[model samples]
Target: MWLGSEFCARHILRHCDTLAGLPAFWTREQHGEEASTWLLFTHKYDYLKHLADRYRSRAEPMTRTFSITETAITTSPPRERVLLLLAVALMESFGIQVNLCLDPAYRQLEGFVLDRQRCAIIANWVDIDAVWHVDVNTNKPDLQRYADALDHAQARSAIAAKTPTGRLTALAGLLDLDWQWLTHRCGELAAYGSAGIADPHSRLLSTAGVDRACGYVATVATHNG
Candidate 1:
C-alpha cells in the first residue's frame, strides 16, 4: 500500500533514469528468466556488450555510469562471499553500483566488509535503533561515504494528533537520536555529492506495476541490499 503510493508519486515527479534491480525489465524484454532469477542478475551479453563498448568509449574520460542492484541482505560474511563478493565482482566487471537495504540489526563486521567494497546501504527507521541506521553508502575510491537522510520523511503513529513541520518534534524526539550528528552527516553526504535512487516501473514499462512484489527484497539488499 505504502510502496504503491510512492511509485505513483515518483511517476508524477520524475521519469526513471535507470531501472535497476528489476529482472522483469530484462527478462520480459524476452530475456528469459532462468537460474539468473534466483541469483543476482544483470543484462545479458547483448546489453552487456553494449555496456562494455560504452565503458570503453568513456575510457578517456575515466568515468563510467552505473545502476544499482538493490538486494535483500543474506546478512554477514560467509554468506556474502558467494552472495555479495561474486555478485559485486560481476557487476563491477560491467560497471554497476551496488546498494544494500540493510537491517539495523547489522553488525560491526558488516561495517568492515562493506567498507571494503565501498558499497552503499539503505536502512529502515524501525529497527529499534536510532539514526545510526545509515540510509545509503556509496563507494568512492579510497573513501567510504554515507547518506544518512531518509527517503522517508514523516512517519505515521496510531491515534496521534499531528500538525505542520510534516512531523511533530515531540513525537520524533521520542526516537532519542542525536540530531546534531544526523544533520551533520547529511551535510557531509551533500558535500561529497552522495546520491540516492528512486525507482520507477520495472521493465521500463510505462509504469512499474505496484504489486506486493514491488517491495520484494529477501534478506534483498545487495541480494537483500
Candidate 2:
C-alpha cells in the first residue's frame, strides 16, 4: 500500500515497540556480528513485507487498481523526505545520533544510527518509489538486493517513467489506511457489516469502534520529545 511516511512510521511503531526492538540478523561482516545495521534493516523490511502480505490476504478479491492524481506528488514534498524526518525523530527520541543518506541512483533514503566511533548501530532503507509500485506485484525491496538492482538501466528507466498518479492493487488500497481511527477500526468493520444503522456517521462508528486517535498522537509526542 502507498502510505505516507508518517503513516508508515506509526504503523511500524504500533506493531513494534520501537526501532531498537526490531529483530536482529547476522550479516557478512568480518567480525560476524549479528547486530550489523544492514542486517537489522533487512529484518525490519521483512517484517513490513509480512504485514503487507497479511493485509493483502485479507482483502476482497478484485483486479482493479487505485490511483491518486498526479498533482498529489507534484504539490507535496517527496515522501522520502517525510520518512527521513520521521526516522530522525524516532532515533533522536531514543537519544541516538543518526545520519541520513540519500542514494539518488537507487532512489533510496537510509537512516543510520551512529556510535561513538561513528560506526552504524543499525540502518534502515526506504524505497521512495515503493509506494507507487505496491500493487505491481514486483519484488519488494530489501537491503541485500538493493545494490545489485541499482545497476540495471532498465529498472532505473522504468522508475523514471512512473506516472504521477501511482497505481495500487485493491489489497494495497485496503492496507493504505490513513486516519488512526480508520486503521484501528478497519479490522472490526471488515469482520462485521454496518448492521443497518440509521445515521451514516453513527453507522460507521457503530460498526467500527470508538475513535482511538491516541496512537498517532502518542507517536507524535515521542517524536517531539
Candidate 3:
C-alpha cells in the first residue's frame, strides 16, 4: 500500500507540464494501484536522452566557465571519489531508493544517482540523523560530504530563489532537467521490475528528487522554502 494513486501522479504531471511524458515522477506514496499501470506504459527514450544531454551541457559549463571548485570539501581521498563513497554509505544507512547514474557520458560532474525504488534522488549529502530515523554518525566521510553538499546546494539555491532572473532561469532549467530524469528513471525502474531485474535508475532520478522525497517521507523539511 503506497501513498497515492495513478490519478495523483497524473494530476501532478498535468499541473506541471514540464513533467509531461517524463517517467518515474511518482513517489512510493503514489504507487498503490497505479504502479503496475505505469510499469506497463512505454516512453520516448530519445526525448529523455536529449533532455539529459542538454541539462548536463548546461550545468557542466558552470563547472568549467567558473573554473571554480566553488566550495568543495576535500577529504583524505579525492573529493569526487569520497563523494561516491559517501553516496553509497548514505543509501545503505538510510534505505533511500532513488535511481543513480554514475558519470553518465563519462562526465565527471554527472555523478547523479537516483533512487527509483523509492521515487527520489540519492543525495551526495544527507542529514541522516535528521531524516533517517537513526543516530547521526559524526565521523563518516559520507555524512560529512553530504552535509557540505547540502549546505552548499541550499545556500546557492536560496540565493537563486531570491534573484528574480536567477529563479526564473533556474526553475525553467530544473523543470526540464528534472522531468527528463524522472521519466527516464520511471521507465527504467518499471522495466527492471517487470523483467525481475534489479539495477538502479540513476539517470532517471536525481539528487533533486531525493531531497524532495526525503522531505515528504520523513517530513524533515518543508517543500515551501
**Least accurate 10 contiguous residues by lDDT in model 1:** 23-32
Overall local distance difference test of candidate 2 = 0.26
lDDT of 2 by residue, 81-104 (tens): 222222222222222222211233
- Candidate 1 — which residues are off by over 4 angstroms? 1-43, 59-81, 97-225
TM-score for all models, in order of appearance: 0.23, 0.21, 0.19
| Winner by TM-score between candidate 3 and candidate 1 | 1
Candidate 2 Cα deviation (angstroms), residue 116? 22
Task: Kindly report the root-mean-square deviation of model 2 from the true structure over all alpha carbons.
Answer: 17.9
Question: lDDT per prediction?
Answer: 0.25, 0.26, 0.26
- Model 3 misplaced regions, further than 4 Å: 1-139, 162-169, 173-225
Compare candidates 1 and 2 on lDDT and give the better one: 2
Better of 2 and 3 by TM-score: 2
**What digit string (tens of lDDT, one per residue) describes model 3 on residues 48-150?**
2233443443322111000012122122223232222222222222322222221112112211222212222221112122221211122345434433343
